[model samples]
Structures are given as C-alpha cells and as structure tokens.
Target: MEKVRFGIIGVGNMGRAHAHSLLNDIKGAELAAVCDSSPERLDWAEEHLPDNVQRFLSPEELFKSGTIDAVLIATPHYDHPPLAIEALGYGLHVLIEKPAGVYTKAVQEMNDAAAKSDRKFGIMYNQRTNPLYQKLRELIKSGELGEIRRTNWIITNWYRSQSYYDSGGWRATWGGEGGGVLLNQDPHQLDLWQWTTGMMPKRVRAFCHFGKYRNIEVEDDVTAYVEYENGATGLFITTTGEAPGTNRFEITGDNGKIVIEDGKLTFFRLRTPEPQFNAEYTGGFGSPECWKCEIPVAPGDGDQHKGIMRNFTNAILHDEPLLAPGEEGIHGLTLSNAMYLSAWTDNWVDLPIDSELFHEKLMVQVQNSTFQKTPVSQKALDVSGTH
Candidate 1:
C-alpha cells in the first residue's frame, strides 16, 4: 500500500483529536472514515471534517465498508477490546487507546485474536515516546542503576471539576467507566510505572477512597503498596482531587538513585557499589561516597500521540516495529486491576489476578450503580489542552 488508510471508531474528544492529526499532522496516513453512535457527533464531524471523509453511525458499518486498512478504537472503556478484536478478525491493522479494556478477561481475548492475525497491532501509549521516560528505561535496562530496590511515583496532577464529571454520565461511575483516575486519567502513568522499570509487582495492597473527593461513585484518590518478586518494593500515589498537584517518579537501586520531577532528571551516583563497599570498607560509621548529578534530557515532548500514530502507520506500510505493542497493554491494566481488587477485598492481591473474581465484583458495582448520566450534546470543546 502506498499509504495506510485509517478509520476512527469514536468521534469523542480524543477520537476527534486523533482524526485531526491523521488529517493534518501525520504523514503516510489518511483519515478515510469516521464512526460514532451519536447522530449529533456525526453531524459535527461532517461539518468540521473534510468533505471526502466517509462517516458512519456504527462501527460494524465502518468495519464492513472495507475502505480502510487500519482502525483506531477510541470509544468508551468497555468497547475497546470487542471493537479491536472484530477489526483484527477482518484482517485490518488495529490501534487501541489506553487501558486496553475494563478487565483482563476481555483484553486477553483481544490479545489472543491479534496474535492469530497477521495484521499490525499497536497501542496509544504515547508517553513511551517521551525522551525523558525513554532515557529512564534505557538506563534501567542497561544496568546503569544496578538492581532496582524501590520505586515511588506521586502523580496527583489530574484535577477534574464537578462540571467535568457531570458533562458525561460515564465519567466517574463504575458501571460507566469501570474505575476512576486509574482507568480514566492515570492509565499512562500506570503503564509507564511498569514499562520504565521493566518489572511487575508480585503482590499489591491499596487503599482507594471512592467518592472521597468527587461526588462520583468511583475512586478518586488512591495509595498503593507493591512488592516485587526480587524483594523490591514500590509506592504509587495518585488522585483527581488535588489542585496544583505533583508529578514525581523516583527509583532507587544498589548502585545509585534517580529522581524525575518538574521536567528535570537527577541521578545520585554512589562512588562504590553498596555490596562492594560493605565488604571492603574498614570504617564502622562511614558510608559510601555519593555524587549528585542533574542528567540532561532532549528538548521537546517527542510528538506524543502523533508519534505513536505515525509509527503505527509505518509498521503497517514498511514493517516497522511498534513502540507500544497492543498485547503488552495488559501488563499495565493488571496493575490497575490489582489495586482495585486489593481495596475491595481489604487484602493484598497477587499478580496474574483472578480474572473471574474481578469481573464478578465489577458487575456488582454495575448492577447497583444509581447515578443517572446526562445524554451527550453537541458542543464545541477544545480537547487539545485536556491531555
């Protein structure tokens, strides 16, 4: 194919943003079709999008149209897996948004489908393209930081107002969004937590405050403790209630420690390996010598979402490697699901979580939810700044 033709399955805020990028920013990609269940959203796309771009009221219609080589699934939390699986079954390249799906069972089924297909599969983990995180992953993988001992990430900068939640009924409800903060606003961070360290926790204990800050029924604040197989420990703290919040990720290893915050990376290097120093040092009270250094990072944000899309297109056309493979998305979702399960059971949940139990508990919330959501209306929204 000279250029990969693309179809978007949702025309919501994020979906519309992806459509604009495919139309204007990305090369080697064409916005061939767009789909949305809302007639109002379809009308808005018709007015704002190019006249030649085809439009459909349902994803099944677009998938059967056979006009595009790939599809981007940007619908709600529940629809990602089923839509991607259907597209892959049709022999089309598939790119999914974050949090793969509401639960691991559905995502696993989608991954199995993708594995059986010969088409390209990718995920919109755009943060992986950021040079800052890329550099962190490189250092850890290179053994420059030695064996990781601890990791802590305080990412509470996602502040959402009541009006924001009220804008959509599915914004913060369990039946609607499956979970809050972790599922809606912090999937990128959760993904990065495991992606950068190249590790998954063996057990997780979390304390989640449901409707603590927001009036919604889902959790808006959480603090989790994680234990890895190598005896390493981690702390993940996040919320959507704090204003002027903080975003800091720190990791400690045997050789040194690194801190990333306020767009700066700092490394505190030990003059000698802790093990070697402990074995050789004669002094009883002295510690290993340490030097603090501020590591330099490349300028710019690395084109984030657009970069992932461009790579997805190239992977389809030129056999290029994907930055975030669709199947790997399950790792991050596992962490999030473990946290929620821990809170529900008031105990530590192990890795490779019980998929049946999680789904069963989630269905209880969906069945008992009492929140009534307002129907979506056609309104001008600038989603560029939201992400």
Candidate 2:
C-alpha cells in the first residue's frame, strides 16, 4: 500500500509514454506490469522494460496475473470501456485514457460499474493539468467573468501528416478509431471547453468534412455551433489538415472576456457589466469600456500525464481527489458524438445524444467502410512534444 503498482495495458505510443513516466518520473508509483496483444510490442517491452516488470500477452492475462494493484487502460478507443470495466471488476483501480470510448452506451456501462466499485477511478485528461486552463476554469468558477455569453475555440494546430495516419491500421478508420480529429486530437479541447465553462451545450449543429484533407474516411475537419442552456452560444472549429494552424480559446461574459492562446492567458475586463451598460447608456453604437490584462499562469506544462499518474496513485493510496474523474469523461465524448451525429443527419443534435442512433450509424460506417488500413507499426514515437 506504500507505493501503487501499476500495469499498463497496451504498449503503443501513448502507452509507452505512460510507462516511461511511471517508471522514471512519477514517485510512489511502480511500473509493475505491461500488456500488449502484439508480439513485437511484447518483445520491445521485454527488451526495454526493467527485469522485474511483468509482461502479459493480453489484458485478460494481465488482470488474472494479479501482479499489479492498478491498471491503466491505454488500448484503442473501442476497447477502453470493456477493459476498464474488467479492471474494475477485478478490484483494481483504473485510470483510462481520454475520449473514454467510441460511443456513449459502452462508456456509461463502464461508468456504472466504476460507480458500484469501491476502487478509485481516473481518466487521463492530461490537458486538465495545464495551469492556463486551470486558471481559466478558476476565473469562470469564481465569477470573475460574470455570466458567460459566448465561447469560441479554434484548435486546428493538431497537424498530422499522411504518414502519421498511415502509421497505424486502426487509426482514422470508423471500425478502429471511430472518429478522426475530434476523437483523436481535439478531445482535450472539447473537455476543456465544457470543464472550464462548467456548462454543456444543450444542442449542437455541426458540419463534419470527412477526409477533407486526409485520405482517411473519418472526419478530419469540423465546425460546430453549440447552444447552452443559459442561452450562451459557442463555436468549435478544428482540423488536422491546416498548417500553421491556430489554437485559440476565447470566452466572453457579461463583465469580461478570457483568451488563452500561445501559452498565455489574457483577459479583457469591462468597466461595467454589459447588461448595466446597455440599460444605462444613451449611446446607440458604443459598447462598454474595457481594459486588457494579461493573466499570469504558473510555469510549466502542468506536468500533464505524469501529474495525472501521480494523482491517480495518490488517490488510490491516500483517498485524495482525482483531477479527472472517469465518469466526467463522458461529457466530452457526448459533445463529440453529438457533433458527429449532427453532421451526419444534417441537422442539430440535442444533448444526451441518441446513443442507440449514434451506435447504429457508427456500426453502419464500420460495416460499410472500404478504406483499408496499413499494418500497425511497433516502433514507438515520442509524443512528449505533441501535446
């Protein structure tokens, strides 16, 4: 109980990154076991991992081996929910990777299981650790921005080349990864959008351009319009095709506006609330006066994955609160799903999306997909700088 022994299921790129962090960076956490279905990956683990680290051919085997106290599910999108459920059923603490799962039903089932279990559950929403985002959330929660009126995020800087898409067979395919940029690259932004604003869109209308820039079938470019219950409107735009892309997140409220981009947080505060200014002012075209202020955020990339790992271990050991709860991951997934659904149906999609309809549509794509995937590469790519 002194140090949490962690097993990572999937020795892929993100998986190996977690392994390295657990092995070398994170304190009070030990990389006890590693699992992968690929023989090449297992061989790599054997060669690169410590002599004491246990290796398994499958997650089932890893769960049965009982070599670790907890498991980090870093597998593909479809396998995440079932694997997390299995880990939780085995009475092991679980820390699942982002997006939770491809669709909502399976994730809900996993969430239910975790809720019933006494074990600690966390999600690798590493972006939540970013101090700039954390500061934005604080400002909103603290009412420093007053009532939110509009929000916009254009996070297209997730530029992935053809080789990056070709690197894995299971990537960018409906049967494999489910969705493209929204599911893969922009989950963090989607999560941050709702998390920092503390609001979920009541409805979403989106236009998803499938394979607009990439050769893949899934969507690579997306533009979504969302409306909150509080009548706040928002726009989310992203794509992996654009070079020299933008990564700007802006939120406007009655009293102020916050903009986070280029590793800096900026706020524009109004001298008076918009409503008050509108009610009292006689000027027909003038708006409220404002002062621009650059908000200071703590240095560092928030330690990201390592920070989440440390917190997950601590949460299991000392009953500390988790930075990203496993259940809350569904919110972001729901938004993504809603956007996809909206785009598919050519209409607005409501919140708490029709899980059955979405699943049906997804399976259609899976079954009808004609795009063949290339063989998955065993060579791990260093993704430390990508985030």
**What is candidate 1's lDDT per residue for 1-387, written digit by digit as tens?**
899999998788899899999999888999999988778788999999999999987777888998999999887777778889989988899999887988999999999999999999999999999989998999899998999999999999999998888876656887667889999888899999999999999999999999998789999999999999999999999999999999999999998899989988888999898889999999799988999988888987688999999999999888999999999999989999999999999999999999999999888887777643222222121121133
Q: What are the Cα lDDT values of the candidates?
A: 0.88, 0.88
Q: Residue by residue across 64-84, what tens digits does model 2's lDDT show?
A: 897999998887777779889
Q: Which stretches of candidate 2 lie over 4 Å from their true place?
A: 371-387
TM-score on alpha carbons, each prediction = 0.95, 0.95
Q: How many clashes in each candidate?
A: 0, 0
Those runs of model 1 whose alpha carbons end farther than 4 Å from true positions after fitting are 371-387
What would the TM-score be for candidate 1 when compared with the true structure?
0.95
Superposed by TM-score, candidate 2 places the C-alpha of residue 43 at a distance from the truth, in angstroms, of 1.1
Backbone clash pairs for candidate 2 read none
Consecutive 10-residue window with the lowest summed lDDT within model 2: 378-387
